[model samples]
Target: MASMNNATEGQHDPATPLFDAVSHPNSLSKQVTRFFGLGQDRIENILPGTPFQRDVMDCAAKDGQRAVGHVVFEIPQDVDTARLAAAWKETVHQTPALRTCAYTSNTGDVFQVVLRESFVFSWMDWTSLGLKDEVVQDEAAAAVAGPRCNRFVLLDNPDTNERLLIWTFSYALVDTAFQERVLGRVLKAYKDAHDELPRQLETPDSSQATPEEDPNPNPNPNPSRILKIPQVADMERATQFWRKYFSGLDASAFPPLSPPLTIPSPDAQAEHRISYSSPIQRKWSSTTLCRAALAILLSRYTHSPGALFGVVTKQAPMLDQHQLMMDRPTRTVVPIHVSCAPDQSVSDVMGTIDAHDHAMRQFVHAGLRNISSTGDNASAACGFQTVLLVTDSDTKRAATWEILKKTE
Candidate 1:
């Protein structure tokens, strides 16, 4: 195993060994720690839990662990197995966030730790499995969704030149945007490796080239600096703010769409889903319009002039310098209060939303924690219910409807 001393200077501990037991055989654990630049003395690097990560951990604890994101792609016929594997290995090596694990302290505090070791990447050839493509895809998705660990699985169908690459992580570890970025990097790495192979084969002295002498190196010189988890002090003010904001709010303010069915069946049932999209004028942001529309709809449905619903927002960049360091789902979903009078125009509602948004941002800037496990539990104890989600993309507006329910 490579010694910790071999790591890049100024990045890791100098005296700490790479492995706790020198007698231990070369194992995945050692490889993980060495690759991640973790000191041997410290088994793991502790990170303060964000509200989003805490909620996800709590849910995964109750429900079986499931992957929060996945993507499938086909590799070109010309891409060799060695090149693909190399590309994947390089991607794993370059992205440290892919090697994290979550755990709850004995005292009930949720946290995430970098797995210094025990990192595993699997490449399976499913061509001989005698399964249909759909079956294989289903199995692949299940495998990705089932694992509690953070890792990547690459499934290849040798005969068909089809590849299924599943990158699964705890919701705390990644979000949709992060998943997209990771997919792009993995594809780019594969292309770079594929493009370099032909050049190597053409070199007259290629055989003389050594692994250590390879000219190409990781493009990111300092991957460790990518993400800085927020410290307790950083979130203390925000936490207090949110705790007080949701206080005294009716827990049953949002009600379910329909009464629960008395009979329960083990068999799966088909679910119906439909989505429609339309463009919005550039003068009005999609979020503002959606918020206003939702306020009106919710107000009429509930027979209330004002409604409170949760809105997911990215964490403030002021909280961390490396805002995009980790692809994890760090977004904070907080309850927002919206009011629409019977005579209020859409424009008026938009203005109200804008003002509310500004105030919310300011509150967050002033150290308002939107959601905490304790705060959420307290709200639920008081009958706080989640009613709806309004999401706005750059060019389109979207909304999802779900039965209102209290947090488990």
Candidate 2:
């Protein structure tokens, strides 16, 4: 590209990282319409990414815990390694997320962009070396400071006639569901190229592997590991806020209630879905009204001033510092500790819930994490017996309920 004429050079700035920029020269760009629940507007060719991606990256940058997921695949024996590598490279060429990386623009904006150059598919074969997969993974994680989707194949096996292909991907790019599609295509390509491979891959360890340096790639191209997240103040503030709200309040602290109507069995405790309605107020969400009614009813039954519960929402509570607008699972179950006196008006309980939800939008995720930093018993103490979830068509929601049983 550098050898191109001046006319081609005029289209892009040579001083800046063209790949991570908001605008790229002579590129095909499209808008990302995936909703992230925070009223984010997805622009053409530029995405801020989702909150979960941002948080994981934030943890990597601050907490030194990079968000890399590795899944191992078993393959049939007698598979041609070269052909498989070629298939994977072809799959990468077709998938944008495989080559996508997040970056921070000079204007203080975060974006996940697909690199303009051809995807450089890298792989490592540990079958002959007789090494554990962990060593291969550690080496790759240490060597790759940038976001990538890498593969390791176990090949040339004759006994079981099976091999392993370990796929390691950065969560910054795509999730598991998308990864499955990419692998499926790669296998299809592998099956199609039984006689001959469409292309040959330079071993990653080869001298001719690394692409020529990008003239002005950003100093820190991988925003996931390099971005400085200065969220200490906000996290600490939220921490103090939750600590105050939960001070001296644990499951053991709550007043003991009457025994279960039906004898609790080792197998099942039973579930009762009692329906009740209250006046729907425009200002308050349906979730809030339902929660208020439940709290008041529980209060009347328990002869106590308040009740505790769980709120299942995709608030992305840590989304305030930046506009985290990409695609990742953002649902979190936050404990709702309502301490309103029964004599207090219904408005009082509703106000507390609204305020808690508001704080949650800021940094309550960090707050709750710190609050539950103690042992599992403390974690269990903070948990609630009842939980609430409110959903809309724009987003999908799923819940998993686990009943921890004790063996006598």
Provide the overall lDDT of each model, using Cα atoms, as 2-decimal numbers: 0.46, 0.46
For residue 200, give model 2's deviation from the true position in Å. 2.7
Under the 3 Å rule for N, CA and C atoms, how many clashes does model 2 have?
A: 3
Score candidate 2 by lDDT.
0.46
Query: What's model 1's TM-score?
Result: 0.60
Given candidate 1, what's the lDDT at residue 298?
71
lDDT of 1 by residue, 1-408 (tens): 011002232332211111211222233334434543444333333344554665555555545344353445445455565666565556554665665555454334344554333334456677665434534444344333332345545567768766655444556677656655555565677667655762222111111211122244334434333223444454455556556655654322344333221111223333323243656546666567666776677778888766665565655444344333444544565566666678888788898788767656533422112242335533332222442344534433111011011111
- Per-residue C-alpha lDDT of model 2 across residues 1-408, encoded as one tens digit per residue: 001111221233322232333233222122211211111111213444443454455545443225565565555445565677777776665664665555434432235654433334444444455435443554355336444333333333454454555555566555644654565677677777878746855445321223323335454333332222324465456556665666655322123323321111233333445554435457887677777877677666666666666666664523333333333444545566666574688888898878777766554344223444333432433444455655433333221011111111
List the candidate 1 regions with Cα displacement exceeding 4 Å: 1-45, 62-64, 67-72, 115-119, 127-148, 156-166, 194-233, 243-252, 256-281, 318-324, 342-345, 358-384, 391-408
